[model samples]
Target: MKVINHIREVRQRKGITQIKLAEDLQVTRQTINAIEKNKYNPSLELSLKLAEYLDVPFTSLFYLDKSEENAE
Candidate 1:
């Protein structure tokens, strides 16, 4: 299953910049960019941190795309 996230949308709506978020989360801006672009899946700890920092529920920020789970 693929991981999908609303990190960018929520961040933008909340007027948070990637750099600021990364700094606040103690991560690199590239890491945030990668996650936002769906090029990387964050660690569980980071994921929780993101949700907390973004002021959103974990389920609201991230989910699995199971549509392809049974495709094989």
Candidate 2:
């Protein structure tokens, strides 16, 4: 299964910058970038924190893709 996220879209929509989000979350901007690029998967604690910080539901921010092919 692949983990997909709408973090960039939601964050952009909310006018939140990667640096700002990272600072608020006590993480590095590279961490946010990697997560946005699908190069990293956040831990459960961080996932919950992201949802809470973005004021979005967990399902709205992240989901699973069961297909074998790449999402793109």
Candidate 3:
């Protein structure tokens, strides 16, 4: 099953621009874009840092879809 995330939603809700978040994380805007679009999954360290940066719980940011898992 694919792992999807609500990173974009949370980022938007906080009014944080991709560039701003990238700058804060010392990553490229393209990297942020990739993450938001689910084309890339951040590392465990980065994930924790992102959750901290967004002021949210890690669990709330990502989850596995049972539907996707069961579809097979």
Candidate 4:
């Protein structure tokens, strides 16, 4: 199983820069970068905040993957 975050895609689609997102989230750009790279997992509160900021559902930003599902 792998944890995947679609932050980069969502941000791009929303035309939002990492720095801007960081500022809105009150986090560092590095933290946003880490989350985008899957190097860090945000807390539930942060996740909800991100969803709100991006105008996306929480699941649209993050998801769980199964090996079998990924293979398809």
- Per-model TM against the reference: 0.92, 0.91, 0.93, 0.87
Worst 10 residues of 3 by lDDT: 63-72
Candidate 2 residue-wise lDDT, 1-72, digit = tens: 889999999999999999999999999999999999988999999999999999999998999876756754
Candidate 2 residue pairs in clash (backbone atoms < 3 Å): none
lDDT per model, in order?
A: 0.95, 0.94, 0.90, 0.90
Please give the lDDT score at residue 66 for candidate 3. Answer: 81
lDDT of 3 by residue, 1-72 (tens): 666789999999999999999999999999999988888888999999999999999999977668966777
Ranking by lDDT: 1, 2, 4, 3
State the weakest 10-residue window (summed lDDT) of model 1.
63-72
Model 4 agreement with the true structure over 1-72: per-residue lDDT tens digits: 667889899899889999999999999999999999998888899889999999888887888977767798
Clashing pairs in 4: none
Relative to the unseen true structure, what is the Cα RMSD of model 1?
A: 1.1
The sequence of per-residue lDDT tens digits that candidate 1 reaches over residues 1-72 is 899999999999999999999999999999999999999999999999999998899999999988898787
